[model samples]
Target: MSELAVPAPSRHQLALMIWLAVFPTLTVLNLLLGGWLGDLPVVLRTFVLATIAVPIVVYGIVPRLHRLRARVLRGPHG
Candidate 1:
C-alpha cells in the first residue's frame, strides 16, 4: 500500500515555524523569569534562555506545528 508523503518545509517555512515557536516562548519565559534572569550578565542571560528555549521549541512546539501543517495540507477529509 502507498502512503502520502508530506514534503518537508522549505527554508523560509522552517524559519517562520521556528520563529513562531521561539518568539512567544522566549517572550513568556522572559516575562516569567525576568526578575531572576535580570541579575545575570547579558551573555549569560542569553545563554540560559537559549538553553531553556531550545529543547522546548525542538521537542515540544516544532513537532506540534509540523503536525498542524500536515493536517492543514491534508485538508478536512484527511
Candidate 2:
C-alpha cells in the first residue's frame, strides 16, 4: 500500500496560515458585530469572537484550504 506524501508546514508557515485564516474571520466578526461589540467588556467580546471563530476556522475554512492546496498541488487531475 502506498501513502500519499504530504509534507507538514513549518512553524512559521503554520503561524502564517493561521494568521491568514484568523485575520479575515476577525474582520468579518468585527463588521458583523459593529457598534454592539463596543458595549461588551473586552473579555466578553473576546469570548464571543472565539466561540464563533473557532468552529468556522476549524471545521469550515481549514478544510477548504486543505482541499484547495491539494487541488493546486495536484494540478489538472485534482
Model 2 lDDT, full chain set: 0.80
- Superposed Cα deviation of residue 69, candidate 2 (Å): 1.1
Residue pairs with backbone atoms closer than 3 Å in model 1 (clashes): none
**What lDDT does each candidate get?**
0.94, 0.80
Residues 1-78, model 1: lDDT tens digits: 454668999999999999999999999999999999999999999999999999999999999999998888877867
Candidate 2 residue pairs in clash (backbone atoms < 3 Å)? none
The candidate maximizing TM-score is 1
TM-scores for every candidate against the unseen true structure: 0.93, 0.80
The sequence of per-residue lDDT tens digits that candidate 2 reaches over residues 1-78 is 443555666788667777788889999998999588888999999999999999999889877776666666666753
At residue 14, candidate 2 shows an lDDT of 69
Mark the regions of model 1 whose C-alpha exceeds 4 Å error after superposition.
Answer: 1-3
Worst 10 residues of 2 by lDDT: 1-10
